[model samples]
Target: MVGSIKSGKSTLTNALFGGDYLKRGAGVVTSIITRIQPGHGLRARLEFKTWDEINADINQALILFSSTPPEDGGGDFDINDEKDRLRLQHDLSRLNTDQLVSDDTLDPNCVLLTEYLSGYDRVKGLVSSEPVTHMFESDDFHKQKDFVGDESLAVYLRDVCLTLEAPRGFGENLEVADCQGSDSTNPLHLVTIQDYLIQTHLIIYVVSSRTGVRRADIRFLNLIKKMGLTKNILFVINCDFSEHETLADLKGLVGRVEKEVGMIFPAPCVFTFSALYNLFKSIDYKGGVEQAIARKDRRRLEQWREENDMVAFSDQQTEKFLKAVIQKVSMDRFALLLVSNLERISSISSGLRDWIRINQDLLKKDAGEVQEAFSKMGKRQEASDQITMVIKDTLDGTTLKLRRNLGNDVERFFDSKSGEIVQDLTRFIRSYNLSIKDYEKDLDASGFLPTLYRIFQTMQQTANLFIAESINPKLVNFVRQEEKKAGDVFEQVAGPYSLMIKDAVKQYQRTMKKLGIKIQDRPFKAVRSPDVDSVKSDARLNIPRLAGTIQYSTRIKTEAILRLSIYKTVKTVKKLLKKPVKEGPDSAMRSLEASVRGIKKQMQESIKDHFLDYKESLKYQYVFKLVDAMSIELYEALTDRMRAFTGNLSDMKGRIENEGLAKDRLAEELASMQTSLNVALKETRALEKLVMIDE
Candidate 1:
C-alpha cells in the first residue's frame, strides 16, 4: 500500500494493523523509510541523523572550539572570523577517539579544552586521510558526519532495508511489512513500491475514507497499470470512527470514489474499518476500565492544560492501532492461499503429460507406415540393373523375332504404343498440374501461401527424381510390372497422398479459424448507371446543323449592330471635319485626312480590348474544369488507399493474436512431451532394475 504525505495513509496503515508503528508530525517527521515487523520484543535501532540535529551539533562544536584557550597556557585563540571557526570545528568533529575526564564539575577552563579537543578528534577521524581544511568543503564529509548521531533516522532506514532484504518472517513461513507513509511520494518510495509490485504475489492498497484517493494515489495507480500488474490487489479503506451515525454517508462517499477510480481498483475485494475504535477497545482490555473518558472534540487546547496526559493518550492510540493492523494482514495472507489457482496449474500440467504419452504411440505407428511405403519403391542400383537387362534382351532376341514375324509393321506398332504411352503421360502431367494449381488456390484462400510455397520447394527434389530415371531400362520394367500388379502406382499412391493433403488443408483451416481470420476475395465493382437515352438521342441528332443555325443568327445581329454604329460615327466625324477646315483649301484637306486617321485608330483600339477580355474568360473556364476533374480523382484514390490500409491493419491484428496463442500452445505441448518422455524413460529404467534383481 502506498500514498502521498498527510493523506491519512499512515492512519489507514495503523488501522489495518490495529496499532501505530509510524511517527506522525506536522511537516515531514518520517524523513526516511521505516519498516515494522511482528516479533516478541519491542526494540528500535538508529542508523542516521536529521538535518536539524546536524546543524545544532556543528554549531555547538564550533562554540566550544572558539571559546577555549590555546594548549601552551597562553591567551585565547583569535577566532573572530565565523567562516574560519566553522571550518576548524568541522575538521575537529570528524575525528574518532575517546577522552577520559574527571567529572562534569571540572574547572571551566579544563571543560572547555576537553570538549574542544574531543570534537576535533571526532572530526579528524571522519576526514582522517585528507588535509584538515579539506573536510570543510567536501560534500561527502559533511553528509557522513552530519547524520552520525541521530538515532531515529538511522533506525528507520536500517529497518526498511532489513525488511526488504530478509522480510518479516525469514525464519518462519509468513511476513507482513508495515511501511511508513511520510515519504510516500519520494522517488525511493516509488522504487520500493515498484519492486514489490513486480516481485510480491499480493498487495493490499490501504486508503483513508476521510482523505479519499489523492493525486499521488492516482499516479501510483497509473504506475501499476504501466507495469501491467493486473491481479492480487486488495483495497483496505480505513475509516477511524467509533460511532455509526455517519456510516451511510461514508459508504456513499466510498461508492463515489470507487466509481471514479474503478479502472485502477480492479481487485476482487475492498474492506473498510475504524482503527480508533479498535484502539479504544484495546485500552479497555489492557487498563481494565469500565468507564470511558468522554471529552468534547476541539481543534486545539490551552498549552498549560495537560501535556503528559496528551502524550499517554497518543501512545495508547498508537499501540492499539498497530495490533489490529497486524491481525488483519495475517488473515489476508492466509486467505490468498485459499483463493488463488496457482496449485491447479501443476495438476493440469500432469494431465497434459498423460495425453501426450498416449498420442506418441500413434505417431510412431504413422512413421513406420511412411518408412515401409518408401522401401517398396526399390533402391537406385537394383532398378538400374533390371532396366539394362530388359533393354539388351529386347534388342537382341525380341527385335529379331518381331522383324521376322511382321517386318516393318513391328516398327509401326512400337511407335504407336510409344505414342499412346506419351499421351497417357501428358494427361497425367496435366492432371497433376491442375491439382497443384488447385492446391495453390487453397493455400491463398487460407492465407498460408508462403508456407505452401516452402512445402512445394521441399517436394520439388523428390518429383525431379521421377523425370531423371523415367527412360532407364530397369525403371521402365519396374514401372510396367507395378502398373500390371497395381493397375498404376500413381492411382495407388495418390489415395493416401490425397488423404494427407486433405488433413493438412483441414489443419490450416482450423488454425486460421482459431485465430479468428476470415479470408475471401472481395472484388470492387462500379455502381454508376449510364444515361442510355441521352446518349442515343445525342448520337441521332446532328449537332453541327443546330450550331450552324445559332451561329448564323448571332452573326447577322452582330453585323447589323456593327454596321449601324460605325456608319453613324463615320457620318458624325465627316460633318465635324467639314466644319473644322476654315483657314484655307490646303488646311481643309489636312483637317479631313487627320480626322479620318483618328477615327480609324479609335476603331482598332476598341476591337483589340474586346478580343483580350474574351481570351481571358475562356482561359479561366478551362482551368476551373481541369482542377475539378483532378480533385475528384485524388479524393477517390485517397479513399481507396485508406480502406486498404485499414483492412491490412485489421488482418495484422488477427495475425498477432494467432501468433501469441500459437506460442502458448507450443510451450504447453513441449512441456507435456518432455514430461511424457521422462516418464517413459523412468519406466524403462525401472524394468531394467527389476530384471537385474531377478537375475
Candidate 2:
C-alpha cells in the first residue's frame, strides 16, 4: 500500500481483511512496514532494531546539541555522560518554539529526539547487541497492537510480520504490506516505501475524497512510472460519506482523479469506496465490551448507509478490486507453473511416440535391415550431441561478454567524481542558498544554536527531496536501459540456436514419420528470455541517511560559542557584542555561509560512500546473477529437448538380444505398450490445450 498520510490506507487494509487487526490513527503513526499474510492461526512477529541502529538514532538526535564531530566521525554527545545528558535536556528546553509541537509537549519536528528522551529507560534493555525478535500467538496477538499504535514503542520496532487465517479466496502465499505514508516528514519513511515498492507485485494507491489529487500523489506516481511499475497499480479514491452530498458528488471526484492519474499513466483503474464504512460493516461483535463499541460504530454506519446511495457502487468497486487481486495471485502465478509442466509433458510424449515407432519397424525388419537402421540412429545421436555442445559454448560466450560490458557501464555511470548522479547532486548542493534572514525571527527568539539546527534540518529536507526527485529516477532509467540492452544481446545469440534445436527435433520427427508414426506438427517456441523484472526487487537505490551529520563541521569554532552564553554568543561570536546591529547581522550571515560550505562537503562524502556500496550490489547481486541464471536456463532448455530424442536405444536392443524372447510374443508386448503410450499422449495433449486456453 502507498499513499500520503491520512489517506485511509490502514482503514482499507482492515476492510480488505474484514477485521480490525491493525490499530488505526489519524496522524504520523505507522513508522515501520507491517506485513500481513494468510496463515494457520493468529501470530505476530515483531523485529526490533539492533544496538547499533538504536545508537545511530540517538546520535542523530543528540548531534543537534553536540558542539562538533569527533575525529572518528561520530557524534560528540555520549548518552552515559552526565554533562552531555544535561546539555541535551537544556537544549530540548530551549528548542525553537516553531520546531516543537506546542509548549505543553516536546518537539514533533524532531520525533527521534523527543521519543528517545521520553522512552529511553523503557526501551534500554529492549534494544540489545543483536536484533531482537518477539513472537505473539493466539490470545496474546493483541499485545502486538501496543507496540504498533504507540509512538514511543513503535520507534524501537524495525518491522512487523503478522499471520492469521484470512477470509476465503485469499491465497496462502499472498502477502499484503501496510507501508508508511509517501509524504512522511521522516525522510527514511520514503526510503522504506521505495524499498517495499520494489518487492511488491501490485501497489494500491489511496487518495482521500476530501483532497482529490494533491501534488504529492502525482510526484509519487511519476516516480513509480520511472521505476517501471506503472502497470500493476490500482488507485483508490477513498470516499468520505460525510463529505459527499450524493452519489453524483462522489462520482465526480472519482472522474477528476482518474483524469489526472491518466496524465501520468494511461487508462487508470480507479476505485471509489468509504473504507471506514466497510470497516464498520465488516466487523463482527460477539457481546459485552466488543458489542458496546460495535453498537456505536454500527449506528454511524447505518446513518451513512441511509444518507448516501453511493454505498452500492462502492461495494461493486470493492468486489472488482478483490477479484483483480485474486487474478494476480492465483491465475498469473499458477498459469506460468502450469505451462512449464505441460511443455515437459509434450516433450516426453513426443520422444515416447518416436521410440514406439522405432520398435515397431524393428519387429518387421530382417537382421541386415536392423543393422542399417541402428547405424542411422547412431548418426542422429552423434549430430544431436554436437548441436548441444555448440549451443552451450555460444551461450557461455555471450553471457560472459554481457557481464563484462554491463559491469563496465555500471562502473562508469556511478564513478565518484564525474558520474552523472554525482554531478547532479554537486550542482544542487553548491547552488542551495541558505539565507539567515529567512529565520531571523526564530534566530532572535532562540539564539544561534537553535536556529543553526533548524537551518541544518531545512538543508537536509531539501537535499533528501532532491535526491528522491532527480537522482533516483535517473538511476532507475539507467538500470532499465542496461537491462534492455542485455536482453537484446541474449536474444540475438539465442535466435539461430533456437532454430538449430528445432530443426534437429524436426529431423528426428521426420525419421519417425518415414516409419509410419503420426505426430502433431507445430512450431517450436523460442528460448525463454531472462526475467528483467528482477531488477525491481534486486537493484535498490535510495537517499542515504543524511540527517545526523549534515550539521557537523571541523571549521566551526565551538569554543567561542561555549565561552559566551546563548544570547551573548550570538553577538560576541560575530567579533563584537557592542557592535552596531547591521554589522552584527553581517558577521552572523558570513558564519552561516561558512556552515553551508561545510554541509556541502559532508553531503558529497556521504553520497560517495553510499554509491560505492550500491555499485557492487547492482553488478554482482543483480546483473551478473541474472546473466548466469539465464545462461543455465538456455543450456538446460537446448540440451533437454535434444536429449528427449537422442536417449540411448542401444540398451533396449541389448535387453531384447539377451532375453531372446520369441518374436511373436515380443511383437504382442510392444503393441500393447504402444497402445498405452498413445492413450497417455492423447490425455496430455488435451490437458495442454486446456492450459493454453486458460492462459
Candidate 3:
C-alpha cells in the first residue's frame, strides 16, 4: 500500500485485515514498510540495516546536498574539517536522527543501529496487542523515520522493515504491505516501493477521498503501472471519517480519480472504503466474538468517535456505515482474492504433473540413443572435458578474486607509504639551520655523523614498513581467505555432475520411486590444507642508500650561511663559516639545494625498484606454489565425484532394467494431486461468493 502521509494507509490496511494489527497514532506518521502475514503466534521481528548500509545512505544524502554548487559560489561544506562538519550533523539531528547523531558514536553514520524483537507471545495475550504493536514506534524504527521532514509526521524514512500477523480470519494466505506516502519528496523511497511492488500479489493505494487525485497520486499510479502491477491494484478512495454525504459525491470523487489514473486502475478496481469507521467497527464487531472488549479499547473507541465527529452516530447510522463497507469493500475481498490465486497455483501444479510425465517418456528415448553413442566413444574423455570446464570457471573465479584483493593491498601500502615518506622528508629538510653562519653552534658539530646516520635509519625503517610489514600480513590473510573459497570450488564442482546424471537417468525409470532408485548424496572431499605459509614473508631486499653528502662546499637553502661538507677526495669534513669575496652566498645555497634534491630523487627511485623486484619474486615463491598444490587437490576431488556419479547412474539403470517399472504408483499419485486441485477450486468459488464483488 502506498499513499501520502496521514492518508490513512495503516488504518486502511487494518480495516482490510478487519482488526488493528498496526499501531496508528494521530496525524501524519513515520514511513515504514510493514509486511503482514498469518502467524501461529503474535510476534514482531524488526531488522534495521547494518551500520555500513546506514553509512552509505548518509553518504548519499550528504553527497546530494554537497554536489550542488553554492549559489554565490563561495564553496561547498568541507566535511573533513571537524567544526565545519557540525552543520550537517545538526541538520540530521534536527530531523530527529537521535541515535544516529549521538556524541557516543565516534562516527554517527558508521555506527550500527541497534536491533531488537519483541519476545514472541506464544500465548495469545490479554488485551496487549495494542502495546505490542506500539513497540515498533521506538528507537531505530522511530528516529530513522523523522529524517524525511514532516515534523508532525515523518521527517524521513530509511532502513526499517516491519512484519505483523493478524488472526486467522483476517490473514491466512493473505499478505498486505504499507509504505511511506506517495507525496514523499525523497526519490529513494520510490525506488524501494518499485522493488517491493514486483513481490506483492496486489497493491492497495489509499488516497483521501477528499482530494480525489493529485499530481503525486498520478506519478505514483504511473509508477505502479510501469512496474507491471496494474492488473493487481485497487485504488481506494478512503473516506475514513468524512461527514456523511450523498452517493453522487462518492461517485463524483470516483469519477475524477478514474479520469486521472483510470488508465491504470479501471472503474471496476476503484474502491471507496472507510478506514476510520471500519477500524473502530472491526474492534466493535470483535468485542462480542472475542471474550469482550477491554476497558482500554472501549475508552479508545469513545475518543475516536468524538475526534471524528462520530459521537452522534446511533445504531441505525452505524449499521448503515457498515452495510456501505460491505457493499464497497466487503472487508474479506482481498483475502478471498488471495485464496483464488492459491487455487490457481494448485491447478498449475496439476498441469505440471502431466508435463513431467510426458517429458519423462521423451527423455528416456533420447537418453538411450545418447548412451549408445557415448558407450561407443567411451565416457572417460567426456568426464575429463566436463571437469576441465568446471575447473576454469570455479577455480579461476576464486583466484581472480584473490588477485584483486592482493592488488588493493599493494596499492594501499604504496599510498600510505608515500604519505609517511613526505612527512619524514619534510621533517629532515626543515631541521637544517638555513641561516646559521657557524656550524659549531647550530649544525650539531659534535655528533654530525650520528645525526646523518639517524636520518638514513628513519628513511630505511619507513621504506621497510611499506614494502615488508604491510604486504606480509595482507598476503597471509588473502591466502587463507582464498584457500577457503577454493574449498568451496571443489564443493561447487560436485553439483552439476549429479544434476546431469539425474536428468539422464530419469529417462529409463519414469517411476523411479517404485524401482527404489535413490540418487546417492555425497560430498566432495574438501581441498586439504594447501601450503600458504610460504606466502607470508617480507618481500623487501637490498635497502637503498643516500649516504654521501654534497660534492661542493655549500649551504642547503637559498638564504643559508651554515654548511658542513664531506670532501669526496680526502674523506674529511670541513665546516664553512664565511664565503670568499669572489664566491656569492646565494650561489652556495643554490648549489647545495640542487645536490639535496638529486639525493632525494635517487633514493625514491631506488626504493621503487627494490619493491618492484620483490613483488616479482613473490609470484615464483608464493602464488605459483600455492596455486599448483590447490589445483592438484581440487582436480582429484572433481574426478572422484564424477566417478561416483557414473557408478550411481549404472546401478540405477541396472535396477530399472532388471525389475519392472511400476505404472500403478504413478496413477495413484496423479489421482491424489487431482483431488487436492479439485478441493481448492471448490473453496475458491465459495470464497468468491462470500465477498460481494462490486465489479
Candidate 4:
C-alpha cells in the first residue's frame, strides 16, 4: 500500500487483512517497508541496518546538524566522540526554531540526527550479521507495535518481513507491503518506495478523503507512470466518516478524487470506504488495555453508522475491490505459471507416446532389424552433438555483444557532466533560489553565523529532495529499459535454436519411420521466451544518499558581524552566495554550487559502480545464465524426443534374443502407458480450455 503520510495506509492495511496487524496513524516518519505474506501463524523477521549503514546515517545526520563544528577545527563531526556528541546536541539547540522544529513537524534532517543520538545505543545490540526473528503469536503480537510505531527504533530497521495466518479470500502467493508515505519529509522514504514499486505486482494507492488529490499524490502518481506501472495500480479514497455527514457527500468526494486521479491514470480503478470503520468492525479487541480503546471506537462506529448509513455502500465497494484484486493476482499466476506448466506436460506426454510407439514397433522386429536401427541411432546422436555445438557458439557470440551494449548504456546514462539524470539535477540545483533577503530578520535576531548555517542546511535539504524526487525515478526507468533490452536479445538468440532442435527431432522421426517403426507426426511446440522476471538481477538500484558534503567554517568573529549594518551585510551575503563566479570568498551560493557539483560527481561514481555490478549480474547472473539454461532445456527436449528410439533399441534386441517373450510383454506395457498418457492428455486439454475461457 502506498500513499501520502497519514492517508489511512496502515488502517487500510489492517482492514484488508481482517485485523489490526499494524499500528494505525503512526505519527513518526516510517523508514522501513513492511512486507507481509501468507503463512501458518503470526511471526516477523526484522532486518536491521548494518553497522556501516548505521554509521553512514549518523554521518549524514551530522552533516544536517547546522551548528556542528568541524572536528580538530577542520574536519567533520565525529559521531563516536563524546565531546562531539555533547557539542552536537548543543549545536542542535542553537538552530533557528523554524529550521529545527515547526509545530509537530520536525525537519527531516534533524529528525535523523536526533533519532541516531537517541536510539543508537538502544538498537545497537540488535544489529548483528543476520536478521532477528520474532514470534508474534499468542500474547507476543502486541510487542510488534513497540518497534514499528516508535520512530527511533523503526529508523534502525532496514525492512520488515511479517507472516500472518492467511487472511480469508487472500491468495496464497499474494504478498502485501506497507510502504512509507510518499510525501514523507525524509526524501529517502520516496526512494525506498520506488524500489518497492519496481518489485510490486500491484499498487494500492490510498488517498485520504480529508485531503483529496494532493500535490504529493500527483507527483507520486507521475513517478509511478514514469516507471511504467500505471496499469496495475488500484486507487482507494479512504473516507473520513467524521468529515462527511451523508452517503451522498462521501460519494461526491469520491467522484472528485477519481476525476483528479483519472487525469494521471485513465479510467483508474477507484474504491471508496472508511478504512478506520472497516478496521473497527473487523478487529477482535482482546480485553485489558484494549477494552477502553475498543469501547471508544465502537461508540464512534455506532454514531457514524446511525448518521451516515453508508456501511452497506462501503462494504459493496470493498467487496468489488477485493474481487478485482483476486482476479488480477490469480490471472497473473495462471497465465505466467500454470499455462507454462501445462504446456510442458503436453510436450512430455507427446514425447512419451512417441517413445512407446517406437519401442512397441521394435518389439515386433527381429534382432537383425534392431541392429540396423541402432546404427542409424548412433548417426542421429552425432547430429545432436553438432546441434549442441552450434547452440553454444551462438550463445557465446550474442551474449558478449549484449553485455557490451548494456555496459555502454549504463555508462551513457550516468556520465558525470552530460548524463541525463545528472544534468537534470544540476539544472535544478543552479536554478534553486535561497532568497537570502527573507532571512534578514533571522540574521538580525540570530547572528550571521547561525543564519549562514541555516542557509547551508536548507540547501542540503533542497538538493536531497531534488535527487530523491527527480533523479531516482529516472534511474529506476533506466534499469527497467535495460532489463527489457537484455530480455529481447535473449529471446532473439533462443528463437533459431528452438527451431533447429525441433527440426532435428522431426528428421530423426522421419528416419525411424523409414525403418518401418511408425512414429507420431505431431509438430513440436515453439519454446516459450525466457521470462525477464525469472532472470531479473538481484541488485537493487540504490541511489547514492545525500550527505553533508559542503563544509565551511561557521566560526566568524562575533564583533565583525555586529560591526556591519544589516542592509549592507545582507547585500554582501546575497552577492557572495548567489553570484555565478568561478572564484569568490566562501559565499553560500558558491558553497551550494560546489556542494551540488560534488553531489552530482558522487552520484555519477555511485551509479557507475552500481551499473558495473549490475552489468556483471546481467551477463553472468541473468543473460548468460538464461542462455545456458535455455540451451540445456532445448537440448534435453531434443534428446527426450529421440532417446527412446535409440536407447531402447538394445533392450528390444535383448528381449527378442530371450526366446520370443517380447511381443506379449511389449503389448501389455504399451497398453498400460497409453491408458495413463491418454488420461493426462485429456486433463491437460480440459485445463487449456478453462485457461482460454478465463483469459
Candidate 5:
C-alpha cells in the first residue's frame, strides 16, 4: 500500500491480515516491501540487497538525513541539538572520508559481516530505555562477519522475508504487501516503489485525514497511475494518529482526496479506517497479542502499549470509531471488493474455457468433410482452406466476445462502486460532534519543594521513552505475519483453478459421450507454492545508539546553576535562622522553587533533542527492504494462474487439431458448441450478467 510516513500502511497490512505483524513507529517501518503469502510452515526467507543496492539506499538515506534544508523545516534548532553534527561525523568516520580526501583506497575488507544477534540479546537483556548499537558491515562488499539467529533475531532484522501461519482466515492467493511512505526522504526507495507497482494488483493508498493530499502524495499517486496500477490502487484515509473524527469529518477528508487524485483517477471516496482504533475493535489488536503470547514475542507489544497509553487511547477511539468505520469507510466493503476481484477472474477464465471448447467441437465435426474432400487431389487444398477459414473466423469472434464481456464487466464494476461512494461521501464525512468551552475558573495548585537541589534532580530525570521501544515488536510481529500471509496466498490461488477447471471438464466430457466414444479426462497440474527458508546475510551493521547517548548538552552549565542555587538557598535559610529578615521563610522558599521551575522547560527540550537525533534514522531504514523484496514475490504469485491458463489454452487447441476422433455426431442438438447454451456456459454468463446487472 502507498502512504506517507505514519499514515498506517504497516498497521493496515496488519489489520487486513488480522494481526500486527509489521512494525509501526513514529518513523518509517516499510523500507522494504513486505509480500505476504501462504507458506507450508512458519519460516522467513529474507534476502539482503546486494552491497551496491544497500549502498545506494544508505547513500540516499544519509543525504536526506544529513542536510537541514528548508524542506526539512530548517531553523536554528536548540543549542542542545548536536545530532546533526554528530550524525554527520559518524557518517564521515564510517566512510573513511580522510582517506577519500587523501586519494587513497579504503580497506576492501570494510564490507565484512558482523554478528548482531548476541549484541541485540545483550541490549535486550539490559531492558533499559537506553539506545544501543548493532553494527552493520555496510561499507564494503568483500568483508564478511557471519551472524545467524543464535538466541535472538531483533538486530538481524532490517529488510526481511517471513513466512508464518496463525490468522484464521489466511488464503493461498491473498497477498498483502506493506510499503513505505510515498514521500519517503529516500529517492532510491521511491524508484524501488515504481518497480513494485508494475506487478501490484491491489494497493491500499493510505493518507492522513489531517494532512489531506499534499504535492508528494499527488506525485507518488500519479506515478502509480502511469505504471497502470490505477484500478488496483485503493485510497484509505487513516485518522488513527489524529483526534477522533466523526463521519462528517471523514466525508470532508474524502472530498479533499478525491479532488487531488481526481486529476488522474476520480476516486469518489477513499476507505477511512483507523489502524490504531482497529487495534481495539479488530483482531489486529486481539489476535496479534494472542499470537505474540504463543510465540513468546508478547513482552514488547504488551509493554509498549501500556507505556504509550495505547489501551486507554484505543478504548477512547473504539467508542467513536465503530460508528465511523461502519457508517463511512467500512472494511467490510473493501473485503467485498476483494471477493469481487476473485470472482471476476474466475468468470473471465470460465468464458475463455467455453470459447476454447466451442472451437474444438466445431473442428471435430468438420473432420469428415475434410476426409471426403481429400479423396479428390485437386479439392484437398480448397477443402482444408475452407475448414481453416471457418475455424479462424470462429476464433476471432470468440476473442472479441470475451474481450467485450470482460471490458464491460470490469468497467461497470468500477462505475457502480464509484457512484455508490460518491453518493455516500458527504454522508460518510458528515458534520456531527459536540463543542466545549474552556473551564471558567483557574485553581492555583501548590506542591511541596524539598530543596533547590532535589527539585532540579527531579526535573532532570530522563524522559525514559526508549529509542528502541515499539520497534522490535513491530519487526517481530510483521515478519511472522508475512510468513502467515504467504501461506494464505499460495494455497488460495493454487487450489481453486484446478478444482474449477476439472469440474467443468468433467461436465463437458460426460455430455459428449453421445458421440459413441467417451471423452477422456485430462490431468491438470497445479502450480506448487514456492519453498521459503531463512537466509542470513554475512553482512551486519552495528545498530546506532540514540537513547543511551542522551545527556544534557549543557550539563556543566546546568550543574553549575544548580550548585549556585543551592548555595543561595542555604545562605537564605541561614539568614532566616540567624536574624529575622523583612522576607519570611515562605518568601525565600518561593524564590528557590521558581528557579527550579524555570529549568524544567530547558531540561525537557534537551531530552527531546537527544532522542530525536539517532532515532530519526529509523524514519526510513529497514522499511523498504521488505517492500522491495515482496513486491517481486507477489508479482510472481499474482501472474501464475494467468500464465498457466494461457498454456492450458494452447495445449487444448493443439490437442483438438491433432487428434482423430470417432463419436456419434449427437444431433445438431448440441447446437454448434460455439452457440451452445451448455450448463456451464449458461452459469458463467449468468454470473457475468449478475455483476453487470448490479451496476
Candidate 6:
C-alpha cells in the first residue's frame, strides 16, 4: 500500500516482486483498483468493476439510492447532482459512525439507507454549485481531478476480496495494489487508504521527481500523519532518466522531494529509479529488432540500408541503464531485509528482563543496609549525654576560677571601677556581637559550609568572653587597668578576652579530637637536621687568641677616710579651725555605711555587665554541644553505611559485568546464526539460478 498520486507506488511494487502489475502512464493512469496477487504460473490478474457496480456501491454507502425524484420529474436525476448529494452525505456521516446501521438486505428502506438519506439532501445542496460529477467521470480524473471517490471504493473492494483467498506460494501470497494517484482531495480516498496502510504490514510510498512534492503530496502526508502511518511508508522516487539525463541530477531532485515528503512520512526505506527505463528493459529487444532487420535486409540494397538503420536505432544501450535501475529497485528489497533483521533483534527480551531482576535485588540490599545503619546510629544517644556533661564541667571550672580569684572583694572593686569597666565591656560585647552578626550575614550571602564554621567559631569566642567577664570582677578590673594603661578599654578587654577564647577553643578542639573527630590545626615543622656540608676540615691555634699580652699603667693614691656633712631645716605652723573635728564612733559607723552602700551599687553593676557579656557565649556553648553530639553520631553512621554501600556496589558491578558478558555472547550467537541462515539462502538462490540457466 502507498499514498498520493505520482508517489511511485506502482514502480516500487513492480521492482520488488518483478513484473509490471500496475498501469504506468502519464499522470493517474490507474483509474480503478489493480490488485497483483500470486497466480499458478508467472502471470498477473487485473480485476475491474463495472461503472454500474461502482456507482451502486457509492450510492449505497452514501444512502443516496433511497432518494427518488417525483414521477413527473422522471427517474433521471442529474449524475452531477446525485454525486454531490452523495459526497455531502458521506461527509456528514463520516463525522459520526454511530448513525450507521447494519443491514443484510441492500434495499432503500434498510437501516443503513435511512442514515445516509438523512444527510444526503444537506450535503447535495452544499456542493451543488461545483462540477464534481463531470470531474469524477472524466478520463483525466486519475491525472488531474485531484480526488477519486470511486477509485477509493475500488481499492477497498480489492483488499476485502483478496483476503478471502487461501495462502499460496511465496511469490503468489504477496499482493501489490495500484491505487489512484489523484485521490488526494477525496476524503473517502484518504479514509480507505489510511485504513489500508494501518492494516498492511508493508507499504511503499511512490513519488515522481519530475513533479517533485506537490500540493497533493502535502495532502497525502497530512492524511498519513492523521493516520499515524509513518512506520509503514517506504519512499520510492520514480526518476525517469528520459526526462532527466544525469543520475546525480535525478538523485538531487529526488532528494529534495524525499526531504519535503519525508517530514511527514519519514519512511525507513528510500529508493530512486527511472520507471520508464524499467518498462523498456523488460522487453525482448534483441530478438524483436533482429527479426525485423533480417526480413528488411532480404529486399533491395537501399532497403537493407534502411533495415540496418532500423536495427541501429533499436540498439538503445539499455543493459547499463537496466543495471542502475535494478540497483535502485533493490533498495526496497533491502528495506525488507532490514525490517527482518530488526524483527529478529526484537525477539531477544531476556537481557532487559535479567537487568530488571538484578536491579530489584540491588535495591533490596541497599534498603537493608540503610536500615542497619539507622539502627546503629540510634544507639549513639549516650554520646550526646557525655558531651553535655563535658560542656557543663568546663563551664563549672571557669565559674570556680571566678569565685576563687574575686569572691567577696569583687563588690568593693566594682564600686570603684564599675562605671568605667561596664562601659568598656559593653562596647567590647557590642563589637563582638556586630562581628558575629556580620559573619552570620556573610554565611547567609555565601551559603558555604566553611563560612558557616567560621561564623560558629567567632560566635563561640564572643560567647566565652561574655561568660568569663560576667563572673570575675578581678579579671574585669585587671582588664580595666590594662585598658587605662593602653588608653583604649575595649582593646584591653578584647585582648584578655581573646586569650580566654583561644584557651576555650583549644579545649573544645581537644574534646572533639578525643571523640575521634580531629579538627584542622596550624602546621608545625619538625627540628631541622644538621647540615653536614657546613662542617670544616681544618682548625687554627694562636697564642694571641688566648689573650697572651696587654700593656698597662697604674697610679696609686692613698687617701684617708673623709667625713660627710648633713644639714636639716624644720618649720612649724599652728592653725585654728572654725568647726571642730569630732572623733566619735557614730561618725566612723556612718562613713562605713556609705562605703557599704557604694560597694553594693558597684557589685550590682558588675553582675549586670558580666551577665550581658556571657549571654551569647553561653547560648553558643549550649548549641555547640547539641550539634557536636548529633554530628558525631551522623558521621559514624554515614561512614559505616558508605563502607557497606561501596562493598555492595563492588559486588553488583562484578555481577553486572559477568551478566553483560553472557548477554553479549548470546547476542553474538544469534547474529551468527542469522548470518549463516542468510548465507544458506543465498547459496540456494544461486543454485536455482544455475539450474534455470542449464534448462
Clashing pairs in 4: 577-589
Model 3 clash number: 9
Model 6 residue runs over 4 Å out of place are 15-17, 26-32, 42-55, 58-69, 73-172, 265-268, 285-695
Per-residue alpha-carbon lDDT of model 2 for 415-498, expressed as tens digits?
987889988888888888877678777666765556566666677667877776677768767876877887788778767887
Number of the predicted model whose TM-score against the real structure is largest: 2
Residue-pair clash count for candidate 2: 0
Candidate 6 lDDT tens digits, 167-222 = 22223334556665644332333333433443344556666767777777776666
Per-residue alpha-carbon lDDT of model 1 for 240-274, expressed as tens digits?
A: 34322354666775676676568675533555554
TM-score of each: 0.29, 0.85, 0.38, 0.82, 0.37, 0.29
lDDT, candidate 3, 270-320, per-residue tens? 556567666776778766543245677677666556643333333334344
Ranked candidates, highest lDDT first: 2, 4, 3, 5, 6, 1
Segments of candidate 1 deviating more than 4 angstroms: 12-21, 25-31, 45-156, 160-172, 180-185, 240-245, 288-695
**Clash tally, candidates in order:** 36, 0, 9, 1, 65, 12
Candidate 6 global lDDT = 0.36
Residue 101: error of model 3 in Å? 22
Which 10 residues in a row give candidate 2 its minimum summed lDDT?
541-550
Location of the lowest summed lDDT over 10 successive residues in candidate 1: 543-552
Which ten residues in a row are the worst by lDDT in model 4?
Answer: 551-560
**Per-model CA lDDT versus the true structure:** 0.35, 0.71, 0.43, 0.67, 0.41, 0.36
- 5 or 6: which has the higher TM-score? 5
Error of 2 at 493 (Å): 1.4
